[model samples]
Target chain A: MSYRSIKLIKYPTQEFTPDVFDITTQAIPTPKEGEFLAKLSHLSLDPAMRGWMSPDTESYIPPVTLGDVMRASGIGEVVESKNENFPVGTRVMGLMGLTEYAISSGQGINPIPKELPAEAILSVVALPGVTAYQGLFEVLKPEAGQTIAITAAAGSVGSLVGQMAKNLGLTVVGVAGSQEKCQWLTEELGFDQALNYKDADFAEQLKSVTPNGIDLFFENTGGAAQAPIFERMNAHGRIAVCGLIADYQTDSPAPGPSWLNIIKKRLTIQGFTMPDHIHRFPEYAQALGGMLAKGKLKYRSHVIKGLESATTGLDLLFEGKNTGKLIVEL
Target chain B: MSYRSIKLIKYPTQEFTPDVFDITTQAIPTPKEGEFLAKLSHLSLDPAMRGWMSPDTESYIPPVTLGDVMRASGIGEVVESKNENFPVGTRVMGLMGLTEYAISSGQGINPIPKELPAEAILSVVALPGVTAYQGLFEVLKPEAGQTIAITAAAGSVGSLVGQMAKNLGLTVVGVAGSQEKCQWLTEELGFDQALNYKDADFAEQLKSVTPNGIDLFFENTGGAAQAPIFERMNAHGRIAVCGLIADYQTDSPAPGPSWLNIIKKRLTIQGFTMPDHIHRFPEYAQALGGMLAKGKLKYRSHVIKGLESATTGLDLLFEGKNTGKLIVEL
Candidate 1:
């Protein structure tokens, strides 16, 4: 058994400062029927987690409870198992709570390969990867020669969505919070162009970037930054809404554009929860992994060292600090 | 030919006062190959006609040019035809440009039954009826026990939409401008509830009418009226925008509510032009006519006596003066 167990003892309410999270020692418990215990390896820290702590206003998902171990999906080794389905040494990933030691009842857990390195398992073929792959390829259905726009172009899901659309021959433009992220999106990710949303002329930049107008929009951030941009979308545009990272930090609710223009343009905007696509996870992962293996797609992970720094990783996401996927390694 | 041949004509614009229309004689011409010519018998006067007069906007259909013998769809008889596909004396409904004698190149025309009364062809089974049918039945797809809220609920399209939704087992609630129209919708049209938008507590009335939150919104009006109603839509609700009569009356542009709430509720809003569904016209007419003949469906036509009253009919539509379908009989 793993001697050391790290647990997120409390859920954060406001902006995730260092004091908001507490990591405490825990005794690894025995597994009950249909249950298996996992030693956490790669913990995913996403902007969506901020939404999970907000008051259960209206969302496709529920918020994490108080005094409970914070919820997360991560890849780790099954050190102890009471279920025959997942025996010892079965490396798996799914909704394992944020802790070094986790006892999952096999509720949503699935086996990961031992061949792949632990951290890469959380990168190339993880939930974030599937989100990008499915939302772009399956939902948005962008055509070649069409223009596509995505917010947070250098982040995990947005980067992959833009790159996938690019690989399919679409003209890709990215919007990012900083110039460095914009540069990386254009130069490194092969995006046709990138706009620094932090600039005062961010919305105006959209008109110039997509002169003919965006045929597809992969909505990542949903606030003032994303609202004005909707007017630049072409007729019959399809938008696959993955997350609204911008509103996650706000105490007030984010309002949408009047959308009279959206109606006239015949835009289709659909919000999806990734858990709804779990059945096709393996299919999405394999296809994207093949692209990754062939050096076609790449993603960066801003990794924090230990469980004690988990809040730092989450804080970085809220502050728009990181340029890519934020992960915590314990 | 029968002696009656009353025709509609236009005067000038830049003002809404009289002298906007003038009548003149036009030659009767024969239909060429693949075309049919129908003698104008009845013209459908609708609220959408107001939007069609503007020369600048790129609407679903092109605006009628000023000084043209105003464009309209009407029931007509094939008095003379050169085309073999359509024989002489065959009954037809065509875009005859609001003339008693029209040469239709079959751009937008449908054949009406010889047996059905001429007035029936201009009322139900026409643009207004099929628009309500296709939009509510096809696009919205509401289920039994669900609530449907229709604005302009006493207008031709809205009245039919609420009744059809009711036939499909939805609890239909209507919103009209006047107490009389609201009473007509509730008592005469069998809508479960009706609210006068002019009521001091209009928003509260909307809440009371659709206590479960509206599942489908048949949006016939878009303006100051639509803003508050959107807040009463349930999660995953659908809004089918057929006409925006409210904005067409104003010389200035219209603005609607900002769209942020659509995401939180995961709602879908779509705008459509009915002729886009020309392929389903025959089917739509059959179902609508069957419902009408069986007394399962009721329709009212606020018919102006002569083509000279077309201007009055149109003005009446903008003023919400008519209860149901507005038409001018020659």
Candidate 2:
């Protein structure tokens, strides 16, 4: 049988827009020893995919080179398997992605429930969920009664951060790119306040909402938005920077506010990668999963129709078209 | 009895230059019910004083008012006092002032031993000394066998940070302004290596010394010293921002070299004020005083002659002239 795979056949040198990918059909490979073939149901499209296209090297994984099927995370049903650990009809999710069918050699992939929906194995219930959970409680560690203002608060991780902050009794404020997203942040996600960063009076609105000062800031999109908030930070404030999508796709250097304010406020600004806290996975899945099960957690996703639209789904994130996690269902 | 005391004038806005401060002697009042009086002996001339001169806004404390005597930490003798908690002739070191005398309302001052030379009390035995101790061990928390780099290596806090990091079994690299300071850091202060940041290839030399990347960094000077070190930080590296003296006196905006790299490296950069860790002072003083008394730790100081010369001492710190602590002996 033949399966189609979308690969980044050309190296993107400049801006990471469309027309940089190549999709083709190839015969599905047969499983060897310790291998399994899975039928993909869902795949995650993330802004980090742009970083993969860049020439920067990573420690554990090889850079995604030209003519290679782009790497991604997805969940699928095992149709055939020779490996005893992963039997046929079992389900798994991990870095096995961007295709209708895949043969896994088992580096990082792990088997899960065959009955679980693909959405659970994908965006909000997957890495984005865990990223927000660990980054909020573990990395930022805002105390109860403190105020937290976050960018992209309508997006997956940011939305979860707002909800979790509210649950943990923190005063939550959100900054979104549009009015609708801001509305969603305040009215639906239960954030104490929301600011539309695209508005001209956005800075003023941010000040009005957090007059006492921001005790904790969860930075997802970093750029111009970081300036005014830097000035109004309280003494000993903390900033947890998980993503800087505002400058991710652009090649030009992004200008930032003065570093003096960071020192003046005696801030603790930290950058964290989620898997680094993989040691706390069971705790997170247990705690956040319990929150999810209790209906205390709320998450949303903008899912594109098919694997062919995965690339477009990612671009929407850069344009701020998608409010939450953007996923592609095949 | 006639005693002259200086009070906190209005908050200072300009640099600690000549026109920035005014001196007036007022009759010192007798200690009331819970009050005490101390005759100032030696005053700490610190880079942190520059930050205290910000606009009449909130900081770690209210900005020293315009007409109030300049706020400072000093080792002084209780010349006359009524409070039983602090009797006559006892030497106490605490946040006193630039004035010759201070009358406390039993606020934050603690009376001490008359034996500690005024210079030693103001130098390595007091706030600056305890600052380096707590900042390096408590905030930066360097691990044994790891590499640590400290900026302003010859200054008060930097000198002590180098020694404390060294005592913690870290390979300490200190960056100072002058050749003499560099030599002193390595030869006298137990730093494994020292480099002059004024060198043209200073960044390259730093990279060579910290080949494994900086596991911990004591950031005392921000502007030029911190920019290059940002690129050389290891994953999960911790930076304790003790001070930022390089730009302390500058009115213009300083430079920033895309600290977004802070995220890719997964670093933790935290700025700390000593008073925030005041609860840990007794513990810190015990450890540091023991280290000093045992001859395991050593510190240096640049002394300026009288209260009138304190302005010149402040400029010496800005010019990076004095090695180790800069103090004004009255």
Candidate 3:
């Protein structure tokens, strides 16, 4: 039998185009000693994928080399196995790429629990949950009664972050692209306030909502909302820069606010990525699973059909079209 | 007897001109119970004074109230005292203002050693020295072999920071505005490399000097050199934002570099001011005094004569005309 996989043929100039990837069919190979062959059930399309496709090698993780199967994280069930740890019918997850079948030597793959649905595993117990947990707790170090402002509030990572902060008794203010996303943050996730960045008087609205000024800022989208929130930061405020989704598609990203405020407010801004803390994944996953079981965390998946839809589906994240976690199902 | 004093009659529009001050003669008042009288000797004119004169009350310290004595730090001798800790003939230093005499209740005053010259006290063991110590050891937390790039490298605080870092076995690069200042950094202060920001190929020079990429950045001036130095930071770099002297005088400060690099490099940028760390002054002062005694620290004073020169001498700092620590000698 043959399997289909998408390969990145060319690096993008400014933004990703459909021509950058090529789909091909190859014969399914058997697993070697200590290896397993698994059929991917779901693929995750994340914002970090843009950095992986770029030519910049200085990023937290090395970019996916040209003409290689595009890098992605996914869930799959072991169909054939030579390794004792990962037997047939075991559900596993890791950086398994955007393909129907993957042969793993059991290096980075982890066997997941069987009871959880594929969407729950990919959304909560995977990259988004771990990233949110690390950025909010470790980087920002939120304290109860402290106010926190998070951008891209409707995105998978941001949604988890706002919920966690809210659970900890923080005054959470969320910034998103649309009114619907704003509503979801305030109505469903229990965020204190949600502001749409597209509004004409967004800065004034932000001022009105955050009367005491922001204390912690979880920056995911670096765009129009950044300056207003930064201006309102109190003394000794901390900022955790997790992503710059707004600038990913453009060659010329906008300049940041003046450093004068940095000195005036005595602020601390730190940038982080999940790859640097990969060893803590299992610990974070366990904590996240408990939260999910306790009904303290809520997650949604924007599922697309088939592996072939993965290439075009990524733009939904960049364009802010996807309502929640962008997932491709085979 | 009457004493000459300078008062802040008006706040500047964008830059400090001579017209902002009002020279006045006041009767040297007697000390009340528990108060001591201070006869000022040498006054220190620092870049932080600009923030004190501005209308921004959100700064690290409150702005100097209009029509009040202009705030400044100076060394003085106690001529009369009702307080036992600071008796007559005691040498003390604190925020004594722009005057020849001051009255103190010993709230912020500290007694200094009589053997040290006023220049050494103002240049190394006072505000400049403690600031450098806190920013280097407490904020940046430098390791032995790491590379550090400091802006305003020839200034009092920057000079002390470079010498201390060099003594700790770190490769130090200094950025200055003039060739003389650059030479002073490399030749006199023993900086590993000193680049004049005015050089047309300053960025190229910086890149060639810091081939290993900057691991620690002591940001003092946020001007032309900031973007280039920021771009060269290595992964997990730490930046201590101490001052932005370049932007202090201007109504429109330049926008900082894009924060995209902050994520790609996982950089940490923190802003700090001495007022926030007042309680640690004694500990830092003792450490700095030891460094000076061991010949591990060197400092210079650009002394201007008379109390009236204090108004214009401050301009030397903003205009980059002052060669060392700007001081006014009575």
Provide the overall lDDT of each model, using Cα atoms, as 2-decimal numbers.
0.75, 0.78, 0.94
What DockQ does every candidate get? 0.34, 0.50, 0.90
In candidate 1, stretches whose alpha carbon ends up further than 4 angstroms from where it belongs are A1-26, A200-204, A224-228, A251-254, B1-39, B55-58, B78-88, B99-101, B208-212, B224-229, B232-235, B249-261
The residue pairs found clashing in candidate 1 are A255-B260, A256-B259, A256-B260, A257-B258, A257-B259, A258-B257, A258-B258, B11-B20, B11-B21
lDDT of 3 by residue, B1-330 (tens): 899999999889898897889989989899999999999999999999999999887888899999999999999999999999999999999999999999999989999999999999999999999999989999999999999999999999999999999999999999999999988888888999999999999999999999999999999999999999999999999999999998998999999999999999999999999988899999998988898899888888999999999989999999999999999999
Instruction: Indicate the residue-level lDDT of B143 in model 2.
Output: 82
- Backbone clashes in each candidate structure, one number apiece? 9, 18, 0
For residues A208-234, write the lDDT of model 2, one tens digit per residue. Answer: 989788999898888767776777789
Q: How many backbone clashes does candidate 2 have?
A: 18
Q: Which docking class does model 1 fall in? A: acceptable
- Candidate 1: TM of chain A? 0.93
True contacts kept of each: 0.27, 0.52, 0.84
TM-score of 1: 0.87
**Top of the candidates by TM-score:** 3
Best by lDDT: 3
Ranking by lDDT: 3, 2, 1
- Work out the TM-score per prediction: 0.87, 0.95, 0.99
Q: After superposition, how far is residue B328 of candidate 1 from its true place, in Å?
A: 2.1
In Å, residue A236's CA in model 2 sits off its true spot by 2.6
| TM-score for the A-chain in each candidate structure | 0.93, 0.95, 0.99
